[model samples]
Structures are given as structure tokens and as C-alpha cells.
Target: MKSEPVAGVRPEVKRRAEQGSQQLQGEVQKLELENLLRTKFPFDAIEPVPKGEFGGDVLHRVVGAGGQSGGTILWEFNRTKNWSDAWLAKLRDDQRTAKAEIAVIVSQSLPKDVETFEMVEGVWVTHPRAALPVAMIFRLSLLEVALARQSTEGQQTKTEMVYQYLTGPRFRQRVEAIVEAFSTMQEDLDKERKAIMKQWAKREEQIERVMGATVGMYGDLQGIAGKPLQEIEGLSLQALDAPVVNNRSAAE
Candidate 1:
């Protein structure tokens, strides 16, 4: 069945609402990425790009002490409802402007061909949660490339083999495996969390139901036995309400 626009709602209002939501979601993902890169990731330096800059949103670097290690990874995060082809072109341009060797776009929406992550038009496109694994792979690639450069003088064939492996489909498979594992773990955690919450809610309802029955039974005993009925501590509200009743009597 086809759905129509919400009754009596302006299209402009809906558009603004969606834009606001997307902006908020993007901010949250950006903050999370910052924390992971700063604390957990192996990047030697992490830099946040300023707004309206002609570069990527974040710049990450792996620096080795006067050794074979120097590369920059550019990152862009998006949370829009749909994927935009323009994003890939723009990030590529930003990658060049920032002189980053690897450019990654972490978006909520992926291109039709991409499921978890993929190299599209020379740029990496991935789900926001899978961004770390992608970054790690690229980070390792940079480190390995550095090592390869140092060793290539003596073993050119071996270095070329390593380079070939890094760029091959096998490398992409490894990334997909890591991303799939992380995504599965996250999905399981969410399910467990929701199940536990549902259980708590059900238990609360049962408790409330039992209390209601108990209170009703107490009231019935009072009606049947009149003054001879014993008052239950928590269930009997008459004693507490007696003073209010007497005050009203006095007022009358």
C-alpha cells in the first residue's frame, strides 16, 4: 500500500525536522569517533578539522620515530537518510586537499552496492560502527607500507608481493570479516539489552497486578467483617484517612 503525506502537515516542516535529526545523529557519531580515535585507536596524532574547511572532518596520522612510518587518513561522517553520490566526489577532493592517502566516509546510509563497507571510486565507504575496523586496516596498511619501503632496497620482489596482497580482494575480505564480527556483536548486545528491559517491564506489571488484587482482597475482608476485620499494615488506608474524615466532620 502506498502511504500519503501526514495529514495537515507542511512538507517544509517535515524536511526541516529530518534535517535536524540527521544533524544531531551526525554529531553523536562524530563525538564517538573522536573518543575511539583518541583513546583506543593506534593513531599517533588525531586532529579535528574545523567547520567550513576544505579538508576532511578529521585527520589521523600514524608517525614512527624517524623510521618508516608516515601516512594520513582522512575521515568524513554522514547521518543523512539517503546516500548521496556527491559525497564520494567531495571526499575525494577533500582527500587531495588534505593530502591524505586514504579517505573514508562513515555514513548511516550506504550506497546500494555496499552492505557493510567497500572501496567506491577510490574512497572507503562504511557504516559508522564499522569505521574503526576500516581505519585499523588502513592504519596497518600504512605501517606495512612503511616497512615495505625500508625493506624494498634489498628485497624488491617481497615488497611488491606485500603491496599486491594489501591491495587485493583478500585484504577487502579481511576488512569485511572484521566489520561483520563487530556488527554481529553489537546486534547481539542490543537484543540482550532490549530483552532484559522487556523482562523488567513485564515483572513490574505483574507486581502491580498482584498488589491490586491484594488491596481488593483486603477491602473485601473489611466489608465482610466490618469492625472485627484486622487491618493490614500497608494495605489498610482507612486509619490514615480517618483523621481527614474527622476534620471534615468537625468542619460540617
Candidate 2:
């Protein structure tokens, strides 16, 4: 049996398929770079620019300790395209608009003599392998320069005031002074409490003696009033045996 003739693939279909494959590969590369940046610099902030925003793939903002913003770096990625001068111009524009200190292009293609990163027309161009290192260098250098400027301009004096106060020896001395004052106050309070308690005891003893005398006077008055001796004895016994009010229960 004769086999049917096979049809050749159309040129347009092949071209579209190739383009789609390249697009997919580019996306994968972008994601890998993004993840690497995020993992390498956990403290820094990394954001992907939306399409038609800055013509940049990612934006990285360096963050100092205590959540202070340090500097900005703008990044662009190229997979299959050749390096072009127009890209540098676009990067410069984007850097200005983003207020970024550094602009970098990570590409798979590089000039014949270029091995890693090189400054070309004020924009940094690097291979994929060197992208992270280049980015880190720019970020740290810019951050250090910014900090130095701030220090020289006295912009950081207010920020450092609290830190100095909390960490200085004067703070420790003040704390010790407070502790000593509190101890003295507590000792005085204890002495005053004891003195009040002693005075209360003395008053209670005097009251008891007065109560006994009053009972004795009542018995004498009954005798003078000419009551019977049996009734007088009973009244005197009752007066002397009267129950005292409990001050503690009343206070409670």
C-alpha cells in the first residue's frame, strides 16, 4: 500500500511557535532571578515593575536596620535580544523616574570582550551569573554613601539620640538612683507603720483600764443608791462582764 503524502508545516505557524517558546523561557528566567534576589537579600524589598511602567523587570530598595530606606536599584533583563544602546537610554530615564541610584541590565548575550559587568554609557551591563554580585555592590555602596552624607549633615542626630540615651552609662546610673530612692521611701513607710501600730496598742490598753474603772464606779453608785445586796451583786457582775465591741470586725 502507498503511504499518503505528508504536509509541511507553515512558516508563520513555526515562527509563532518559536516566539511563544522564547516568551516562556524569558518568563522562567525572570522568575528565577526574582527568587534569587528575594532569597539573597531577605531584608531588602523587591518588587516587579508592571508592564509599561518603567520598562524594567524589577525594582529593589535597600532597607537598613530599623526599617529605614537606604537606596533604590532598577533592574532590566534580556534573554534573546542583542545588547542595544537604546536600552541604556531607557534605563537612564527609568532610573530618574524611579529615583534609583543604580541601573543594571542582566542579559544572556554579551559583547565578545565583555566577561561580566561593565559600565556602558552610565548603565551597568552584566551576565546572569554576575547579576546578584553586581546588584549587591551597587546597593551597599550607595547605602554607605547615603549614610555618610546623612551623618555629616547631622540628619541622623535626632535618630541616634534615643539609642545613645538608652545605651549610655548615665542611664544605668539614673536607674540605680531611682532604686535607692525607692528603697529609702519603703524603709520610712515601714517605720511609720510600726509607730502607728504601737500607738494603737497603747490607746487600747488605756481604754481597757478606763472601762474597768467605769464598771467599778457603777457598782459603787448602786451600793449608794441603797439597792439590795443580791441585786447589787448581780448588776456589778453584769457590768464587769459586758462584751467589748470588736473593732477589727467593724473595720472589715
Candidate 3:
């Protein structure tokens, strides 16, 4: 029997659905990784909590490699644009009250080009690196809220200032100077690692060449020593260098 023609879906619709699904999955994965990183490295810095989780408002900057006293201060804003003027004033006051030495901004609205705090350039800034503000800000605010809970013990339900510090411009400048110096140092280290790799590669090539030459010579000697010509030459044999020195091939 002839059946009615079924409605067909457009290629564009399928593509869009796939793209949206991929985006949602990526966001979910990012949040999970951020949470895992935060949990494992909690004491180091105030990492952004996953969306729909607590501690989205508090931003934590690492002191050093997840180990050290007096870790840097971190802060995040609230989503929903629900922050009251009074609360903001209180946060400003807290910023003054906490008297933190360094401030790290990890907002989703922040530009990727931002390396460090505007007030202090040495400090590293780690925004969500996402192009969407609403999502990033929401995540940042979520982290902020999480941090606030820890600081205030859930006494203040709504978002409030987590910390504030009164420090001199010199301190900010020092932080910037340190960050700049650290950047330079990291560059130097990378260059050194590459250089070392190159040198090792060269040495490895030389060792392989010498080993090949020795194998050829050994085959010639073995032929003279009455070994089967085919057996001596066809085997994958490697001969050691003179001085019987230990060969540290980069390949090894």
C-alpha cells in the first residue's frame, strides 16, 4: 500500500542541533574540569566553581604552585544583576577592610588579552576564556558566591563583599614587577628546554652513525673469522664505540 510522504528535515536544522549539543557538552565538560582542578588545588587559589554550584563569586589567585603561605586574594561578582548598591558599598568597604595585597579578576566578561590585574600587572588573571559574557559572568558570580559562603559562613545569604585591603600603589607595583619578571623567566626556561632537546637530537644522530659504521666493520671482521657471510651481514647488529664508553643516545 502507498503511504503518505513523511515530512523531511533540512540539513541546516540537523547541523544546528548538532552544534548546539556540542556547545552544551563542551560547557559541561569545562565546568567539570574547573571543579576538579579547584578541588585538587583548593588551597592554592579560589578557582571558579561550576555553574549552579556554590563558590562562584570568590576568585582565588594562587600564591605559588599550589603551596605557600598567604595565598593571593580572589573575588568574583554575582550574576542576575541582583547586586544591591548597599551590598556593593559593603563589598567596597570589605575590600578596604580585608586590606588584601593583590587582587585577581577572573570574570567571564574580561578580555582574554588581560594578563594581570589592571591595578597590578604582575599578578596573573585567569578569566574563563569564553567569548560569552553572560555565561562567563554567571560562572564567575557563582564562584564568588561560593567564596563568600566560606568567608561569611552563610551568614549573609545574598552576595556581599568577600574581602578588601588597604595597600599602597607601591605594593601593587611590586606585584606587577614580580609578574613581569616571572613571565620573562618562563620564556627563558622554555627556550632552554628547546635548546637542550636540539642538542640531544644532534648527539643521538652522531651515535647512530657511529654505531652503523661499527656494525659494518664488525661484519667485515666476522667474515674474515670464518662466520657465514649471510649470517654476519644480514643480522641487525650494533657495535659499541671505542673507549668502550657508555653511549647515552637521546633516542634511548
Candidate 4:
């Protein structure tokens, strides 16, 4: 059963996010995030929760052709000056209330350890700009799970196992691996794109000069070389653990 939202935010009781100092900024960020998700990911349905809504700032439902269910994601946006551990517990309760499989908090201020994005205590924390890319990986996971469920529609045993795995710690570990891999790639791409754009006026022309001419071939070169070729250098990539310094040739 759905709970009817109570209206009004009590400034005295709930600060920071509820009719508090940064409420206005938080609200704007929430709306902007909603718009970004909708524009980038057409497959999912993004619903902005009313001001007094209990669960989260936004509800993201994964929808496919013929109304296929791919689970849901609960998003909470914050533009506060400091990070709060309280949000995690609050969102966990909200996640249960909304029956969302994933809970994500997009904020400018994150935990000391987390720089860009990371899963902390089963909740996803990310910077606002990186939110879209992080969300793309999440949506893909949901879709993959949906497809698996579809294939095992009649097999109750397999379905049960799948459900178990999803709720299990191993699932979280696997998802973390997926997120880390994607995060590394995303970081590398941004760093490389900027470096390449600066070095060559016509990037396509430069790619042809290097080994393998076509775009696909250029991509293969990147995959094989891991980092940008020596022709492109003077760029620093903070390796997350400890981002490596600018090297002449980051090539394998």
C-alpha cells in the first residue's frame, strides 16, 4: 500500500533538506537531475517526488517495451555544504518504502574517502555531473537482470536463486566491480578526450596517421594501449587510488 504524502516541510525539525537553508538549492538540483536522467535515458521513467514526499527526491522506474519491469532506483539529491551519514539510513528506509532495488545520492559534498562515485554501505554516492554516467551503468544492470528473469520466467528455482544473488553480498560485490570498471573507463575517456581535442585540430585525421585508420580501429588501439599513445601526453590521470602523474607515454 502507498502512503499518502504529508504536506509541508518543518524548518525547525528537519534542517538542510526540509525547508532548511539549502532546501532551495537541493530542490533545483533535484529537478535538474530529473531532467538530465530523462533526456539521457529514455527507457526509464523519472518521477520527481513532491516536496513533502517521504521516500526520496526522485523515483526512477525501469520500463521497456510492453511495460517490461527492470526494477527501480531511488535518487536523492543534495547541494548542502557538508556530507551527512544520516542520509544513508534515511534513504535505506525510503528505499524499502519505495521498493527500489538501488538507492543513489548525488551530492557536491561526499564522504571523505569517496571522490567521484562509490558504493558506501549498500548505497551509491556520486557527484552530480558523474551521476548520469553512473546511472547508465545501473540501468544496464537492471535491464540485464530483467532479461535474465524473463529467460527464467517459468523456472521458479532459477528465479529464486537469481533473487537470492541479487540480495546477497556477492551481488553487491559484482556490481561494485562493474561500477569500478566503468568509472575507470569514464575517467580515462574524459582525460583522453580533452588531451586529444587539444593536440589535433582534426582528431579523425590524427587517428588515421596512427596505427589503424578507422574509428573502430582507433578504438581498438585505445583498448590495446590502455592509455593514450605517446603522441598524446602531458595529461594527468589521478588513478583514483592515487591518480598517476602526467607521463610521456601512458601506453602499455
State TM-scores per candidate.
0.53, 0.56, 0.28, 0.55
Candidate 1 Cα misplacement greater than 4 A, ranges: 1-18, 64-68, 152-252
Candidate 1 lands at a TM-score of 0.53
The model with the greatest TM-score is 2
In model 4, state the lDDT of residue 145. 87
- Please tell me which model should have the higher lDDT, number 2 or number 3: 2
Per-structure clash totals for the candidates: 0, 0, 23, 2
Best by lDDT: 1
Clashing pairs in 4: 238-243, 239-243
Using TM-score as the yardstick, the better of models 1 and 2 is 2
Off by over 4 Å in 2: 1-8, 155-252
**lDDT tens digits, residues 94-187, model 2?**
7766767678889898755788989886678999999888878887887786677567665547768677657743464456446756998999
Cα deviation of 105, candidate 3, in Å: 28
CA-lDDT, candidates in order: 0.80, 0.79, 0.48, 0.79
Model 1 lDDT per residue over 1-252, tens place: 998988758888888898888788788889899789878654378889877877668888877655445588888888878899989867776776676778899888999979999999778999987888887788888887777667666656877878876986446545655675699899999999999999999999999999889888888889999999877876767653555456667898
Model 3 weakest 10-residue run by lDDT? 78-87
Candidate 4: list runs displaced more than 4 Å: 1-22, 50-53, 158-252
lDDT tens string, model 4, 107-221? 9999989999999887999999899999889988988888987887776787788787888645664666577669989999999999988878677767656633444564567
lDDT of 4 at 16: 42
Q: For candidate 2, what is the lDDT?
A: 0.79
